[model samples]
Target: MYRKYFKRLIDIILSGMGLIVLSWLFLILIIAIKVTSPGPILFKQKRIGKDRQNFQIYKFRSMRIDTPDVPTHLLENPDQWITSIGKILRKSSLDELPQLINIFKGDMSIIGPRPALWSQNNLADERDKYGANTILPGLTGLAQISGRDELSILTKSKLDGKYVENITFLGDFKLFFGTFVSVLSADGVAEGANKKNSNEKK
Candidate 1:
């Protein structure tokens, strides 16, 4: 009942409420990005979503215009591509604010598996094995709270599959609350002790 009907209902209500509440921040990020970077304020990239559907995920542009469209965890020198403002935005995770629009549009949920970029292959095999494409991707999930950039795709996929097996209204609530704390602490910025290349294994 919840998955089929109530989940979407909750998504709509919460996403609408979030947009209304965060309107000022959204405007501020837009202006800040424009002032700091000479390019689009929003970054859009193809990501794998439910059933392997491709959608352009939106985020506040946190890198310089010249930065490659590379995943943060894979960057050889992640700091090199970040603008001065981008560093703070990325650290504070304020850059993810644009995903509220994704939630509003039904491209993402507030809670679920964090969507993976199409170029990522570290966990592609496991993602397929876990059947993670069966459901909508999310802005945050168990894997995100558990490790964010620190966890490999295989680890994340495992957590994602676990969430899919036991999704519930209460579970989402817990994951959402946990994500807030994780973001505040800026946890999962790097995986393990590696501090880099969490997206690809050696």
Candidate 2:
């Protein structure tokens, strides 16, 4: 019942509120990216969502316009493509603020497995085997708190599956609160794990 009904209601309310509350930051970053980068202020990339559906995920443009389409870890030199403002946006996680729109559109929840880029075939394949898309993807999740950019795709998908098995209003609330602390502490990067090549290429 929680998964089918009230969860959608909660997603609508919280995501709606978040969009309104974060509007100012959104506007500011939109302008900042325009001033700092040569590309569009917003970056839209196809991501795998619930039921293996494809949706375009929104994010602030943080890399150079001509940045190659490569896995972040495989970028020969990621730092080189990041604009000055992009660095700050990434560090503060403001780059993800745009995903609230994704929430409003029902492509994502406030909490679930971070959506996998469509290009991340290996991760998506693993998720398919585990039925990870039975639940909507999220801006953050158990794997995110456990190890954002640090954990392997397999490990992340496992955590995501765990969340799907036992989702609740209370659990989501707790994840929301924990996410605040995690982001504030700049815990996006995994600790004691290799930041690069976290996803093994299949």
Candidate 3:
């Protein structure tokens, strides 16, 4: 009942209120990105969403205009592509604020599996095994709180599956609160490709 109905309701209410409450911050970020970089304020990229659907996920632009469209972890030198302001945005996760619009539009939830890049077939296939691909992706999720950029793809998918198996209001509440703590502490974040490569090699 919570997953099917009320979860989405809460997403709508919370996201809507968030957008309104955070509009000032958005305006500030918009100006910052413009002053520090030469690109659109928002970056749109294809991501695998609910039931494996392809959707354009929105983010505050954190990379240079010429940065490759591939994931930051795939970049040879992600720091070179990241602007000064972008570095702070990425580290603090302010770059993800635009996803509140995604939540409001029903493309995502406040808590669930983080969406995979559209090209991440291996991760998607792994998620299929746990039936985690059928639900709405989230701004943050169990995998994120567990280890963020530190977890291997297989492990992340497994945790995502676990989240799917136990969707409840209480669980969502904990994950949501955990997200704040995680952000404040900057926990488990990997700034470049090294962590992903190291985890894959392990």
Candidate with the greatest TM-score versus the true structure: 3
Assess the local accuracy of residue 57 in candidate 2 as a C-alpha lDDT between 0 and 100: 89
Task: List the candidate 1 regions with Cα displacement exceeding 4 Å.
Answer: 191-202
Clashing pairs in 2: none
Comparing candidate 1 with candidate 3, which one achieves the higher TM-score? 3
User: Could you report the Cα RMSD, in angstroms, for every candidate shown?
Assistant: 3.0, 3.1, 2.9
Model 3 residue 72 CA deviation (Å) reads 1.2
TM-score of 1: 0.91
TM-score (all chains, Cα) for each model: 0.91, 0.91, 0.95
Q: TM-score for model 2?
A: 0.91
Off by over 4 Å in 3: 197-202
**1 against 3, candidate with superior lDDT:** 3
lDDT of 1 by residue, 1-23 (tens): 98888988898899899889999
Candidate 3 clash pair list? none
Candidate 2 wrongly placed segments (more than 4 Å): 188-194, 197-202
lDDT of 3 by residue, 75-155 (tens): 667888888898898889999999999999999999998988887889899999999999999999998888888888899
Worst lDDT run of 10 residues, candidate 3, spans 193-202
